[model samples]
Target: MKERIMSKDLMNKIDALGAQEYMSDAQLAVFEEHLRGEHERLIVRQQEITNTSMKNPESISGDEADKANAIQSSADARAESEKNKAMLRSVSVALQAIKTRDYGYCIKCGEEIGLKRMISQPAACRDIECETLEERKNKQNPAANLKIS
Candidate 1:
């Protein structure tokens, strides 16, 4: 996903608000809007992928190469759908956090996620430090990060 660019006006507002008042109403609105947009986009893309895959039925009477290609295509679509679903869940959680007035704090450390980080990645639930540490841990032990679902 591309990082959202903060407008100069929003940046100025954030600068004026300071750390103690992080995720001011304006900031939350911005992040909420971005997250909602991403959620809608992912839903549309997932639907498109599903529709396309459905339209391309696997051919049972084709050559072995054609069968293989169809299977690979189906697998690719499934993977992409799964990825979109995961993103949708993240976006939904972020939206819920916004509604609960708990949007900007890091889930792991309880620190402000910072205006710049929230603007750039609206669905983020962790501050950079905690997120970095989690990523490192996941890299070292990938199985620990796997979701059974």
Candidate 2:
């Protein structure tokens, strides 16, 4: 699945970015394999949600609170699944950036994103500088200030 997301050309681009004589190909191969496993797991989770949608009946209970809680849980699960789908799409975009030789650099500032940051947030497009500024802007935006909690 990981290979499917990013093609052989993408791998060659990543290699060019590394530009070192040292053998880092094995490490990248391992990481890609891990990502493939994760993709399979996500597929299973999506399938589970689909199955649940078909099998789950409307909950009825003597205690109204219990029924309400069950409904809320289902709603939360659906919301989370939607979020995962968004993240997967972001991952695809990131892979495209990698192919374009623009991965691990801030789109706004052209600074190299630290290895730790990329490992922790592979789909991140901006480095800390740009992201922090963006966060401040969002915080100041009226729409972002809407109370959700």
Candidate 3:
């Protein structure tokens, strides 16, 4: 995945909004544009992964090592696709929140998620404290966050 590098001017603008206020119209516009760009980029990347996976066939008449490598590569591609899908979902949710005027607030605690955090991770749905607690809980009981078919 390509790393997102926030420009210094953008960071300064976000920082100037202060930590107390909810995202203003300008802030929301910035985030909305960013999320939209990410959504498109992820869609394109997913298509590329799907196309590549379709073009690459598993070795049917190769040495055991070659077969294993092919299997591993396929698995890796699948994992990456799944990750991209999850990110797309997150971006979608963030966009929806922006439309609802609930962006930059923690879903779990109903507190401002802070401009710094939002600027760094626009898809964040929780504040740092709540997020840390949730992460700890997930770590303590990983299976609780998983679904089985």
Candidate 4:
């Protein structure tokens, strides 16, 4: 049947993508391992931030300037943690896409994402054109940062 043939073709495509020579499977594996380690590190860092409250305004019991600096530093750390969390979410989505045979395809336009881009960014969900548009939109309106994958 046509459906059966299409399914087999899809399987073949997936197999080809997974092949070691052309797709940078080994590099992706290394990048994934590095990402996992970074995720763990960020979790530990977040925990440390949560545990450290002496710098908070309520607990500072110190000079006003020092308290202000502490608050600013704490805020910066929280922002960094949030960025890390976002990146982790992107990585998680990329991993799931790989498992679902949806990797290497632009989530937005469905074009084949370049292998070089994929190697450079194992979590990429968009080709350059789509990604550029998304970035421009996000820069213009932060709230419009649509989840790609």
Candidate 5:
């Protein structure tokens, strides 16, 4: 009896996808745990800031200054929360890419992203070659640089 063989392209895609699935899922779990820890830490720090601000009421002569302090603390907490949430979103996107079996190829060049790159940054969308080109292009783009006149 002849042995059934898998197609080469299919096998390659499967292997790449499997590797990404494992790495992405494991990393996602780790990141979720880290996010929880960070959330707790942020809450504690925010509480401390709020408590300190409240205790310094004498420093503010009027309600406006107190309100300004409160607003600053709120904005700081919000920025931290936004950063954490954005990281979570990236992990979720990587997981979705794994599910779709589109995880390990350079989005711009349609080439396989190297294992080293994927291992280091699983959510990467470009291989080194394409990424380098993109970096060069961005560097050359006048609009990418901010100048003060």
Candidate 6:
């Protein structure tokens, strides 16, 4: 059987739990501020990389080594930009979850994810057990990483 709560009771429960048991309003605000800062920084960095020089002055004289070095630098910057983009998405999703009253619960097990874990990684979606299992699976099937998506 399912239980029902009165609106007032539900509100009280929400207040007591603070929507997310582990996350407080102040903490959310702080995290949001940091996330926005990081997002902006990454966005700016990726844009800056787009405008970066493809060759140094020495490379302008047709030096193969300098040309190769410039290519490597561009590739590394692009890789970093991709990494930052992923993190930015995670932060955006975390902020949305915080706003939508789903921030502290584990997506895999529906358990309270705990204050420490949420504080340490605001973008976490699963509990430690689920994450560990996922890691084990990833290690066991390294070929999965090589598959073209």
Best by TM-score: 3
User: To one decimal, what is the Cα RMSD in angstroms of model 6 from the true structure?
Assistant: 11.1
Q: lDDT per residue, candidate 1, 32-80, as tens digits? A: 7767777888999999999978845365567988888888888899899
Residue 64 alpha-carbon offset, candidate 5, angstroms = 6.9
Task: State the lDDT of candidate 3 residue by residue for 36-98, as single tens digits.
Answer: 988999999999999877745454467988877777878889999999999999999999999
Point to the candidate with the largest lDDT: 3
Clash numbers, per candidate: 0, 0, 0, 0, 0, 0
Off by over 4 Å in 3: 1-4, 7-21, 55-59
Better of 1 and 3 by lDDT: 3
Model 6 alpha-carbon drift over 4 Å, by segment: 1-21, 53-61, 143-149
Q: Kindly list the per-residue Cα lDDT of model 4 for residues 48-102, writing each as its tens digit.
A: 7667633555577679898788888888877776776787788778777766767
How many clashing pairs in candidate 5? 0
For candidate 5, the lDDT comes to 0.58
What is the alpha-carbon lDDT of model 6 when measured against the actual structure? 0.66
Where is model 5 more than 4 Å wrong at Cα?
1-69, 135-149
How high a TM-score does candidate 3 get?
Answer: 0.86
lDDT of 3 at 123: 91
lDDT for model 3 comes to 0.84
Q: Give the whole-model CA lDDT for all candidates, comma-separated.
A: 0.80, 0.63, 0.84, 0.68, 0.58, 0.66
User: What is the lDDT, from 0 to 100, of the residue 3 in candidate 5?
Assistant: 11
Q: Give one digit per residue, the lDDT tens place, for model 6 in 15-92.
A: 555545255675566556655665677678767766673445345555788767767887787777677678878877
- Candidate ranking under lDDT, highest first, comes to 3, 1, 4, 6, 2, 5
Candidate 1 TM-score versus the reference: 0.80
